[model samples]
Target: MAHKVFISYKKEDLQFKNQLVSLFNQNKVDVIDKSLNDIIPSDNLDYVMQVLRRDYLSDSTVTIFLIGEHSSEREGNDFQGRPHQAFIKKELQATLFDRENNSRSGLLGVVLPNMYDKVYQGTSICSTCGGTHNIVAIDDSTVIKEFSANYYIKPHNKCAYTEDDRYAVLVKWDEFYSSPEVFIDQAFDKRKEPVANRVTVYPK
Candidate 1:
């Protein structure tokens, strides 16, 4: 039997998400997206939670977050301010808690390769990040500096919830996305590596 993976992401990376879904499908991995359900715009947070909870506990064995530059950006409008991160946090917390009690699998975090360096400040896009599992960039300078600066930040800290969350971070796209084999190896066990004083890109 094949493994079913569920993807939870912000709407900004619709194109990339489709491409990724295609890639995973080609590899014979069963992938599903939460947004496939015709969720109405007027649905309240509680309704959203109900939907997420159902999918989170379905046949899906792992939840992968398709992270982009603006994955954690919080936006507000006149009528109601959508708390994307906070709501996602709640969903994840519920899923994890349920999985822990019911003996289901946990989640995975896969980030866009070099998203932070490539995105601009005013980009009107949102990203999706799993609780922690993430991909790193090979040549992003800010990622190296920030990861070296601090191991972890509070959930509400700017570093953790920035428009571009991969700043000065530990993970690099080059290192993680070198090949499918590398991705597989890290997917099973993601460890925090020591930040090299000088970042270097190796020729593949």
Candidate 2:
């Protein structure tokens, strides 16, 4: 059977969404476009997750998280003079387990090449909106392992949520941008393959 993919990303990544829709159109892949509503408050974490599983994620078997610069960002806690929210966590946590209505879906992360910014020697900042990216990428295996572990571990601080590696298939910005079908296929078919060896490309 063909893969049923659900794309995930911050709403600001419109161009990335367009690219995905366009690619799927040309290649005849299936994309389910159900995103979280904006009006929902971060304080309603329970409702947010409930709606996510029941409404947005119940139909798909894989989630394609377009890992942009700010994909790891989170809402400030309520005590910080704001409502507590963990939308990033909600999207990611969806990948680890099955919704009551759907089977557990795998995750695929396609990094945005444009989100990479060059700051200094051997160091390029990969973040959204000109901010610094604080996530670590020690090596392919380390990166993959860290991601695998973090998906199951939830921290107290919402602002510190940068564990996008739940995506077993991690695609480089250009590699995915140029030829998405190849990697999308990899995500769907090679379920147990060692994604640890997949090339880790950082954009500048």
Candidate 3:
């Protein structure tokens, strides 16, 4: 089956969302961003929360939260003081709905590439609980592994999550294609691959 990915973003991030949607579509991943307009209504915060807690959370195989300046300022949050709330909060809550929801599927974060200044300057608060901001990376296997072990191990919890190796393989494709030589040189141990005795990409 084709991979299912849900994209959560703010209205102000329409352009970025569209770009991601198109990229994933081109790469053959089924995107849930199609409900962009229908999912987030201007006047109905309840509707948005309901859909996330129920519909989107139930069906999506994975979630991709696109972080921007205003993503967490939505109304569902109690307005503690932060600039943005985290989508993971909803994901964890909804993922625990059923006792048997053991599938710890993919969870990814995409930060605005150029918005590091605001993030680093600590100018904004988390729109949800008014906590400090944290940026999680897609390639962090350690975090993913620990989270998976916690959720998927004995006495399984509701917020169980995992990063499939196949997903990592797909992610690595970008690195491989960008600089095949660099990837081969760095990833493979010289002793294990025995490059001196084998064919090398570099000039002999």
Candidate 4:
């Protein structure tokens, strides 16, 4: 049977998500489209969770967070200085604790193109981090920025929630485009295994 995969992504990458959906359909991948972008925004988080559990993530076997630029940005959770109200948190929690068959859906992440880097006060954007900064870049000549934007910040802040979520720290993400199917398969297979929070693209 085909797995019903719920695709999660930032609204900024709508085009990429559509193209990815097309490819999945072309390949006849057994993933059902259960994305929640059809209607107006929910009134509150409770309403949102109600709708998701009752409909959006219904019967989903896996969730593929289509990582993109600003995917991990916590703007949604920043409602009037409220952090716990983050929509992504609700989504992730729903995937693991939705009112379903009491089984957590497998978690898989596709580190899509345009996955961005985060900038903090003591750090500067890497020169090779492509053009444009997603967030405000600071002038920090005193403190040395540990992570240079290469493939280092590729996954964004995936492990922000759990110390160990998925994805081995050493996996070559550059190969994802060439072997997407293989990557998905591997990720799905190991979804249940324990994983460590990846600090760098090239694990130290």
Candidate 5:
């Protein structure tokens, strides 16, 4: 089935975003692009967010977040006077918000090449489980932390988070670009899957 997808990414990652979209086109993948192309034109954050939620994100079935090195950097302050990557955060929040007309989108995190080393290091032996586990560096930003920290349910082993445990499926750029549909389908399935119940759309 052709799924309408919205891409959420920092401006710096536009190149990769273009490449991703192009890959979909070249491969004849069944994906409908719902990403915002033009700027909102208004400086009023609230108004801009309203337009984003109502216009762009309302119909998207999945939101693919491009996680780069600067993706987690807090740039400006929101209405509450707290620092944040206002646009990205708001976009993700809107994607996660379910309403009468709009359902919560399935979330997918794509780690860019620049962040590959930082996010995924070599495997290491887990002290808790005595099993080799992927050494992942996830403390890049509060945005990532807020969304991904809920992957595992409470009282679960930190060293044993399988793909099924994650509310937001994450993949490296190359891996995703190789077979985009596979991951995209996985994300779209989350909408009606049990994992969707564990998702926290709004940040604390």
Candidate 6:
């Protein structure tokens, strides 16, 4: 069940990205790397997006977003005429877009080590369910919000969401690195599920 995967991450997380790539190679993982290596030299935002969608993301089955400390910061002004979101934002948008040539890809968020403590804050008693639940703190970026919002159709009470309720599966870097296939497979399976239809490719 080899899958073509596209990785979306901020420039600061290059080392983690490289480590993930190296891990893939070392494990002889059956995953195809379709991540962007060289920057596309263009001032036109639309052109850059077109190239990314058509070339890098068209065939990718899954998109793994590496969430770092500053991943939510807004940056990038490559588009000369109009204001635009960062490249990572655009990349996730493209990955979620369902076109004739490219269907929506399964989305996975990998929290980097730098933000591990912030993201995973141990367990807490759920006020609503009266059960212990993991306190996961994800960024409030529009891109992240949009995907997460659509994914949890039926939350496990007001306090938490079970893994089955999530459309975009999230994992810590270490957990993901330890067993990449399991997460990738989980993401890939989402594409065929009913939740796939709930995704808003371009959230306003």
Best by TM-score: 5
Error of 4 at 49 (Å): 1.8
TM-score of each: 0.51, 0.60, 0.44, 0.56, 0.84, 0.82
List candidate 1 stretches off by more than 4 Å: 36-42, 73-79, 99-104, 114-204
| Candidate 6 structure quality by residue, lDDT tens digits, 158-185 | 5677666677888888899889989998
Q: lDDT per prediction?
A: 0.42, 0.55, 0.41, 0.47, 0.73, 0.72
Give one digit per residue, the lDDT tens place, for model 4 in 37-58.
3422765766776677557666
Residue 98 accuracy (lDDT) in model 5:
76
Please write out the lDDT profile of model 1 over residues 37-113, one tens digit for every residue: 34434346556655655655455555455556545432323245544444444444433333333323234445576
Q: How many angstroms is residue 39 displaced in model 3 relative to the true structure, after the best TM-score fit?
A: 3.3
**Backbone collisions counted per model:** 12, 2, 8, 0, 0, 0
RMSD of 1: 12.2
Native-vs-model 3 lDDT? 0.41
Candidate 2: give the clashing pairs.
Answer: 69-127, 69-128
Model 3, 69-163: lDDT tens digits are 55432334447542233333334333222323433334343456554443334334556556654343322222222222222333323232232
lDDT of 5 at 139: 57
Output the TM-score of candidate 6: 0.82
Worst 10 residues of 2 by lDDT: 195-204
Task: Give the C-alpha miss distance for residue 155 in model 2, angstroms.
Answer: 18
Per-residue error (Å), model 1, residue 130: 31
Q: Give me the candidate number with maximum lDDT.
A: 5
Q: What is the C-alpha RMSD of each candidate to the true structure, in Å?
A: 12.2, 10.3, 15.6, 10.2, 3.1, 3.4
Judging by TM-score, tell me the better candidate of 1 and 4: 4
Q: Give the Cα error of residue 14 in candidate 4, in Å.
A: 0.9
Q: Is candidate 3 or candidate 4 better by lDDT?
A: 4
Off by over 4 Å in 6: 30-39, 73-85, 141-158
Report the error of model 2 at residue 117, Å: 6.4
